[model samples]
Target: METTDLSTLPVPLHPGLPMLGNTLAFLRNPLGTLHTLQRQHERLVHLRIGGRHQYLVLRPEDVKHVIQENHRNYGRSPAFEILKIFLGNGLLTSDGDFWRRQRRLAQPAFHRQRLAALTTTMIAETANWIVELKQQRSKQPVNMSQAFMDVTMRIVCKTLFGSDTTGKLDGLSAALDDLNYLANKKMLSPLRFPYSWPTPDNVRSKRARTQVDTFIYGVIEQRRQRDEDKDDLLGMLLSAEDEDTGEKMSDQQLRDECVTIFSAGHETTAVSMAWTIYLLSQHPDVLMRLQAESRTVLGDAVTPSPDLFRSLTYTLQVVQESLRLYPPAWIMSRRAHNPDSIGPYTIPAGDTALISPYLLHRDPTNWPNPDRFDPDRFVPGGPKDQLHSYAYLPFGGGPRLCIGNQFALMEMQILLAMLVRSFELKATPNQRIIPKPLITLRPNQSIWIGLS
Candidate 1:
């Protein structure tokens, strides 16, 4: 691997007000500003976010170097601190020894073998939703985004915590929505308009966090009081012991892990399903292919198991392409733990490092016709692995990559195959596909789709 001098880095500062470091400007037009910067400077550019300079890594090689090779030099940024209120020290936010231990314990839960049992659950959830939607087709254009979110939420909740509690989930969903919106505002707002200063959003966020905490704590207590082996991740976590130290996770620790899994597992997969249907609605030929694959791979069966789901290569490829174009975790950041040179710039300790898969996936130099929804780009002999390591970071990379990647993929594949085979998705005329930047990138409005 080659390293470049820090002096040679293209550190172009976008114009901004005196005290704020282009926070408002970036918020207003993040993708546009990044695109403009890419046009004038090298792929790697400097962004003065807040008062500190953060490297906006756009080049594929630079992304790989930071996220994969030198991952230890970086950990998640303080911006993620907002998530701590509910997520606790789960795999998504934990660092150092805590992260390592939790990762080790939780890794098996997402294993191909362990996840195999959950395939029936995933397929059944999808089938139930699809059938319900098919019956209601004449009512009005269905919001596929919300519908999928509901389905994924049910699946994850049932699989993680057993039977569903609609009231608890309703409260949790509302609280999460409030927390995510306010957290984003806090990240982008200047001190003059500090988010903590009695703003409506801040107040709502506090309340929401409380709701989430209450629901999670309730679940934790129920599991502990029962004290019986349930054969779920929570049970395994409770049963797991360290070889050196005989220990189990504290109640708080259990609560955190459960909330983290609930939040992380549901939103991302739901967004992916929504976008896949949106894209499929646009490309009839590809939809036809997906439908054919679904029928061949899984006949009229509603609950095709996870093993059968993973074997559907074409269906998986379509989902992969949708992820490439509209990755739910659109922007990821890391704070430098050690001073390191990335590409032509030296990042000092405590500095933020950014990676936008949205930009990387659309870089024309690496992906030809990058903006086009071409599922064939992911087909066999399409240079999937041959590309730069970081060029395709839909689920992130390196050791800290998403623990549930395999689980999520299996669920999505099964759900998608079941969907396309049963009915065709027709996009509502004049419906807009606005990108709503939540804790994830979601379709802003109801994604209206007619199922036949």
Candidate 2:
């Protein structure tokens, strides 16, 4: 690697409105703004948002540098600091030794073998969802977004806590809705007041947080009182001990991890599945291919088994391409801990680096005809195989990559196989669906699909 003199190179800055700079434009359409920046400015572009200088990394090499090569020089940016309010010191928010410890303890639960055991749970839940859809018996438009959310939430709860949270799902959903809204608002606002201040939004946020905490703590307390050791993520967490200190996670630690899993685990997968279904509804050719593959691989089987899922290669490819277009974790930020070199420019310490997978996945340089809904891009000898390593990061890259990537992938594959095999989904005519870049890349409105 070559070092560049910080003073010698000129960083191109995106011009924006006076005073506010790109703040309003960014808040209005973050993904669009990012794509424009990548297209117009190329590799690395500088911007001033709310008087703060930030760098948008557009090239794969720079992204690799920021996230993998010199990751030690970067830490979770201020965006995640706001997330810490809801996530606490969980793996998503915590850094350094604490994060490492938590990751180690929680890692076993997401292992391939462990996740395989949960496949039956995932398939059973999807089967039940299929039954409910069939009972509708009409071409009634259903909100696939919410439908996916409901099913994924149940799957996560059962797999993680080893209990059915069907009754309490509404409370958890409402609390998460409030928290995500507040978190997004804070992230976009240039001047955010302290969370301690009892403003209306803050009060609502606090109440929502309390609701989430109460439910999580209640579960933890009940499990602690039980004498049996069950086989679930929560069970593993409660029984896990630090090899160095022989200590288990405290209640607060357990709460933070559980909340993180609930928020991060369920919502992202649900959104991915919803977007995939919507995309398939719009593209009949792709849907036909997916269904054909599903039927051939999962013939006469009530549900997808581990071996059956492996054989559904085309179905898996469709899921991959869907993720390419609508990655759940769209934008991630990292703050430079010390002055570091990213390509030609030397990023100053404390400057924020924004990496947008949503933009990168659509970059014409990486994916030709970037916006086209094509699953062949992920097939063998496909366009994806020709791209840079970090070009398509739905679950991100590096050691900090999403631990549950396998779990989420398997869950989505199962759902896609089961649902597509069971139902004929048609997009509601004249309906407009927009992608809203919140904490997750969610549909701005309900995705209305008429099921046969």
Candidate 3:
């Protein structure tokens, strides 16, 4: 469908070497370089990442048109082919009817009722994290990134799979690390390093995938072998039948969905929590306000029970603001399935489109004092719905919007409330907080924070 026609859509060939189109330039400082391109070329800029034509979408209307109005024509980008190695045909990587069916099967598993039952699981996991911090109170400062990773890993495994799989937490963590490394490296690599090669990195990734698959399949097999009923997501999935076909997900289908959920479910939330803690450390007043809000809301109560944090407006606002600043899924991509006109440019069927939350979050036009840390931007008096639908996208928009949004939000809110209520975040005097862009935008180094 034609939206807007621009006979002269400026496609500047930014100074680059033969065969490579703005690859090195874009890689150096992704955000800065994209901003420069946006300024020069306006909302629709055609870039070549290693000779690959990539359209950088900046305007809110363009984003809405692509992601909301005509979403089906776009699927995950070819750049994410590396992710397919690990995730298989999971929700994040899959497209068309496969994505639709998987989403349908998995949606009910994370329904409010099911997630509400897992609130106790979140509390216990966060408490475990606090205990670890309390033990190291004087010994050494805690690494908030690693700590959050561990907490979310446990919570996701326990709540989604079952409590018994908690023993496999270390293996899952290692697998996730390996997957992240391979996926990010492949993004910038020209040769598109083959995972089948006998290289150490390839071998490690393959081995990590095997371990993760083993764990996932083990859970699937055990569920099948068991005659009795269990109530976790896995159990629910096995029981859930398609309304149209009245069919259950095959073993492989179930495993793919599990891996997708396990990967997207935990890692993104972990990154969000890590950034929230790190940012809070940088802004102590925000931290103090959060602590006061949490304590006042939960008075004398220590743990993060559902009743204690369900309506904690301030705490939720802080989490929302954190997501706005450092959205975990930094860049989302989609390739047109058909020739589509977006604003001034005509995108052919094979061309890929990208919506960068990184740029959207820091857009000067949308956010006032865009670089500052102000949770109040989301407070009551703040500009409500002023930002366009796709302007402030952290969880994304449209039919493919993260199905786990509520579950992730609930997990973050509960964990943030529980941790802030118990400890004051103290950042290291000269610690570095570099954003490592991978499957998610996470801290490159450990975020050192001391407890009160």
Expressed as tens digits, the lDDT of each residue in 207-285 for candidate 2 is 9999999999999999989855888788888988888888889999999998888887788998999899999999998
Task: Compose the digit string of candidate 3's lDDT tens values, residues 258-337.
Answer: 88777877788888988888899889889888989888887755465577777788888889888988898888888888
What is the descending lDDT order? 2, 3, 1
Per-residue CA lDDT of candidate 1, range 1-452, in tens?
99866655555555667777766677787777666766666656667877777878878888888878888888879877766653677788888788878777677767777777777777777788877877777847788878887888888877787656765777677676666666666665665344457777767776887888888778778887988776666776777766567777788777778778877778788888998889999999999999888898777766665566656889989989999988888888899998777655677788888888888888887888888988888888786656887888888888888888887888788778887888777878998787776568788776888887
Clashes of each: 0, 0, 0
Stretches of candidate 2 exceeding 4 Å from the true structure: 1-8
Determine which window of 10 residues in candidate 2 has minimal summed lDDT: 3-12
RMSD of each: 3.0, 2.3, 2.6
Give the distance in Å from residue 14's predicted Cα in candidate 1 to where it truly belongs: 5.4
The residue pairs that clash in candidate 2, if any, are none
Q: After superposition, how far is residue 246 of candidate 1 from its true place, in Å?
A: 2.9
Off by over 4 Å in 1: 1-19, 191-199
Clashing pairs in 1: none
Best to worst by TM-score, what's the order? 2, 3, 1
